[model samples]
Target: MGVIQLPSPPRILCFSFHILLILLQQTTAERELKFVVVVFRHGDRTPIVNFPTDLHKETEWPQGFGQLTKIGMQQLFELGQYTKERYSNFLNRTYSRQEFYLQSTDYDRTIMSALSYLSGLFPPSSSQIWNPGLLWQPIPVHILQKSSKQKLHFPLRDCPRFDELQNETQTSPEFQNRIQPYMDFLQTMAVNTGLELNHLKMLDNFQLWNTYDTLHCEDIHNYTLPVWATKDVINKMEKLAELSLLSLFGLYRREEKSRLQGGVLLNTILNSIKQAANSSKQGKMEVYSAHDTTIGALQIALNIFNGKLPPYAACQFFELYQESSGRYSIEMHYRNDSSKDPYVLTLPGCTSSCPLEKFAELVSPVITENWSKECGKQDKMKDIFLGFDVAVGLLCIFNLVLLYLLYHYGRCRRRNNYQDI
Candidate 1:
């Protein structure tokens, strides 16, 4: 009681001091961000569809189905320039073989887009140039084999659950409401094009998707879409394509799907960042060259779609900055519209710059398979018991057969002994 007779400071002052200390701690924690990961859709591409009656069907395009157009290359190049400007501080003035890792799905358009982007992003700096004419430097762009379904690619690895989700999306009340207007638009399209409603449904098929992609590419490159297709129709068709991306990702209908594709990509980026932060060496930027589907899926996953599709040259940028206090922060920038400054992304509990570890933790639930739900409780143990029972029954049958053979042999031997006697 005597020792506590005098309170050192007022309770309000003490509380204020604690609050200030906490703020300082938070500020210190916020300073240590150090990695960047980016996943983006490929720039502009030719149409992936062409009507049967159209004069410039598949025959007009050189290397068929969903190839990148000249405009697509230009779009990626512009994107590269933008990237160079955005990360000028973190990245070396010149592109270094050691500093960057680029990967793409094994698709012609994606591969080409990645190459084009590299050309623009790392245009020969004054010091690195071997010849003035050669603006291109060799940078390794890794391609995942088409068969490696594990690696990130569009129309995500076929899972029955995802397929069911897609079906549900098609039939969902919200989707039905959204598509009702589009259905009316389809009827008009059918009347104008002399195609039946049934045939119009065929437009949703893979072949039709391919035709649309090819034509879209051609239009972008040379201002040549079918004459029957008016600017308004073309715009609508483009929106439909964007919608297709959202559908393919299954993000619009199911929150879980968003976590798998987009969330996984985010987690991967954060993991890379965490690794970079712990290391003494400066981390390299990660680049992904993929389809509009890839971008759409990712954006839907991140809940960042501005209700407009990402254009041919659209890019998403993730930057990790290390503060003077040795803390890290993350900032996401989207360059869907090249005309405007990139839009920043902010997640709850994290600022534009979030810690890598926290980011990974946040997305963990999405990537991890819910085994109990995926494999039903009843079916889970059925297979194990069924297999064990079958094995044991087979063993018992074999032993019984062996005993019978032994008994018969003994009887036969005794008969032979009696004959000898």
Candidate 2:
């Protein structure tokens, strides 16, 4: 989201090679994109966290911290244009809410990113142009309230088992062995940043990530770095950040942790894919605008993570295609580098053209029928109010408590089933 210029061609977009594969599948060799799902990280922005000795403050950035930047807008705009072209044959010439859907985490940057992407994906047709002066038209980008239990927000903090898994990940022998050489580095970073990161556990928790994010953002913006944060020092910090990201969803009991974190999102995506494959009337394409960690969690769940921090505007595509034989196949591709084609991602143990049923079977180990119970969490309420999206007739224990309960229950807590989406 900083000043890093996208490599020229001004359009660094990616389309899956399926454009050719589907052609080969059919006698006519025509486009066969049935349904598509896209999950992408928000474009770059100001750093969200700062070390105690940080040089920049919230006010220093134009829109304050964690908000989208001009570069980010351009990035998503180009990505949207790429999407429009990629699905040209499949998509209607004009915007149609029934054909496409967009959602984003309840954040300024993500909402903004979705809007920017929509601008390029559905630039105004003559009929959609409410204002001829403006080349854009507003489109709906659905969002759950911030308090809702949404899967798009990964490493969801409400799950006790996930927190336990993270603790175990830090103490695992494999993790200790990986960080053994960085003991001195942690101590040096602690001294330089005035942060308490003398132990690997501390780094795994957050201190190291904060340092790396701040420096990475600063470097992206071409800000002068502190003397202690030399090139070599930043490289070491980068490694620790990568490890920290991996710990968030993997490293120990990967499948169990995934069932609680990334698997939740995967479940939602799979359900949509299944419904579309079955000829459900749902939209043809779905896109989620979220964070880098969301991308990491999802890729880790799929067991195809490249083990690198997903860069700004990195988009992952999940396409459902019906082959010439009438069977449905799912294909995944990752577009992290704008300079090259999206890296093809095949579901493990399955071919690139993975059958929908086989893809579900391979990922079955991570998916859960009930994420709440699997997470070892109990949502307690009046037994009478059980199974109700909204609890009516609050207890009369106290007026204030009653009002709070009403407000809380008024917003239906989403179930892991993902049908609500």
- What is the C-alpha lDDT profile of model 1 across 347-408, one tens digit per residue? 55566766656665655655645423442234547889999999999999999999999999
Q: Give lDDT: candidate 2, residue 23.
A: 59
Clashes of each: 34, 1
The residue pairs that clash in candidate 2, if any, are 1-44
In terms of lDDT, the poorest run of 10 residues in model 2 is 7-16
Which window of 10 residues has the lowest lDDT sum in candidate 1? Answer: 368-377
- How many clashes would you count in candidate 1? 34
Q: Where is model 2 more than 4 Å wrong at Cα?
A: 1-31, 198-200, 382-421
Residue 89 CA error for candidate 1 (Å)? 2.3
Residue-level lDDT of model 2, residues 271-310, one tens digit each, is 9999998876878999999998899999999999988999
How far is each candidate from the true structure, as Cα RMSD in Å? 8.9, 17.0
